[model samples]
Target: MEQSNTLLDVKKLEVSYGHVDALKGVDVTVNQGEIVVLIGANGAGKTTLLDTILGINTPRSGSIQYNGTDITGRSADINVREGLTIVPEGRGVFTSMTVTDNLLLGAHHNMHESSDKIERVYQWFPILKERSDQMAGTLSGGERQMLAIGRALMSAPRIILVDEPSIGLAPIIVNNIIEILVNLNKEGYTILLSEQNAYKALKIAHRGYVLETGQVVLSGTAEELLEDPAVKDAYLGA
Candidate 1:
């Protein structure tokens, strides 16, 4: 891919916790206006990679380039201001806060100037507006997921890293989440998605990577991966 079109690029990325290496020289990239998915089983280092990219976990080696600039080891807040945002696993909403408060928190960079963005998010997710005064903790699993995506959208980010968006929801809810993500990509949001639900994720992605034991085992277009025997056996229930 051309450098100018690459929105997020990670090469030889490595991360560790004490002696345990969570990521092992992984390489992944996302281009502008595309949905790139990283699919693997639990403990396949998907979340670690997302966390590393978001600057929540420091990489021990290699480079992370966002918009062609090295952002490796930058603070999470700094990355946030540079139009990189993450809808973390488990829908990390503030349980004690109201829906509006949680959505407003996403625009921390310039709170006073973010009303328009917040309104846009509300428009994308009218349920959030309806529950504006309700505590975020009370929303159902699907509603919480919508709130998480809406909160991420409130920042008007160019690229969003979404981890395990379908973790604990019903099949119908998973479909809803998948539709929202596909729609976001159609609206020109570059997405790097980490998901265990390979079938659904790959269906919406333009390209995909299969991560195993902290290393990337395969990379190709979504159709290629879907047709691969190993992928079909391991993830697609074929």
Candidate 2:
């Protein structure tokens, strides 16, 4: 596939929680309509990086450029409105709300809402449409994951940041979710996925980054990282 143009650029991003550094000068980028995977173990600052980009957590230093505009230090709500959306870790769905309502919250920023986006989400995950009126808490783990991704899509973001998407899901459901994400990428949505499941994540990603203690230790095409002995021993369990 021809490489899409750059959509997001992060240069030497650094974040900290008052004395404990979480991200130390990390450089990452996501191109238009490409799926970029960040694979690392727990506490590697993957989530922190996404949070900083989304403005849920402010960065101590470094710059974030989205579509060539500076977005560092911008509020979370503003970022969402500006076409940057994040489907956070743990599938942060509103359990007490109906599935439809959760999706509406994602579209709150839109001045002219479209039922077509909702319909598209349903088409993507038929189960969500089946449980549209059901409380999110009543849905299965896979259903909740689907709802999370669907809700993010309601915003119609130019880039979607997903953190630990496969965490706490069965292998079959994980495969399903990964396939959906891959399809989304093929449809011209740029995706930045942070995952612990290195093997599965690399399968569909165009490129992969290995984060170690908040730093990018390795980065290459997915096939190259998958074949690396170091990555195989540490993340791939080979």
Candidate 3:
């Protein structure tokens, strides 16, 4: 995709917590409607990068642009309202809240004005609709993962940043979540995904980046990454 069409752009991003630098001069980009995967081991700064992009953590130095507009140092609320949303690493649903209520929280800034969007979410995950009145904490792990992704969709995000979506779920459940993400991309939403399940993530992704210690060490098409011997040994368990 062309630079003009890039939906999310990061340049020389550097983030630090106290004296510990989580990200060091990292750069990444996600074009419109593309599914870009970021794969790496623990402490590779994947979460920090996503959080920085969404304005949760301040970057010591870097530039973030969304649709050509500089969004560095912006607030999380503003970013969400501007169509950048995240399905966090852990299923961040409110355990005490009903399924419906947890989903509604995604549209908090809009005062619940988008019921149609909620219906669309239900259409994507009918089980969520079936248990709309049930407490979120009562749902199974896979169900909670679905709810997390569904809640993110409630915001009508243009580009979603998903973190470790396959963590702690069974293989079948992981595949289900992957399919949902693929379908979402097909429907024109761009995604920047961070996953430890490199095989699955790369299979669906158009392109991928390999991060090591906060910097992009390798970046290529999904097929390229899949066949890379280094990637195979490190991430694919080959």
Index of the highest-lDDT prediction:
3
1-238 per-residue lDDT for model 1 (tens digits): 3777988889999999999998999999899999999999899899999999989999999999999899999998999988999999999999899998998889887686677887888888888889999999999989999999998987779999999999999999999899999999999999999998898899989999999999999999999999999999999998
lDDT of every model, 2 decimals: 0.92, 0.92, 0.94
In Å, residue 184's CA in model 1 sits off its true spot by 0.7
TM, every model: 0.98, 0.97, 0.98
Q: Which portions of model 1 miss their true places by more than 4 Å? A: none
Candidate 1 accuracy as lDDT: 0.92
Question: Per-residue lDDT for 100-189 in model 2, tens only?
Answer: 999998898993655888998999999998999999999998899999999999998989999999999999999999999989888888
| 2 or 3, greater by TM-score | 3
Q: Which pairs clash inside model 2?
A: none
The weakest ten consecutive residues by lDDT in model 3 span: 108-117
RMSD over all Cα atoms, model 1: 0.9
Question: Backbone clash tally for model 3?
Answer: 0
lDDT of 3 at 58: 88
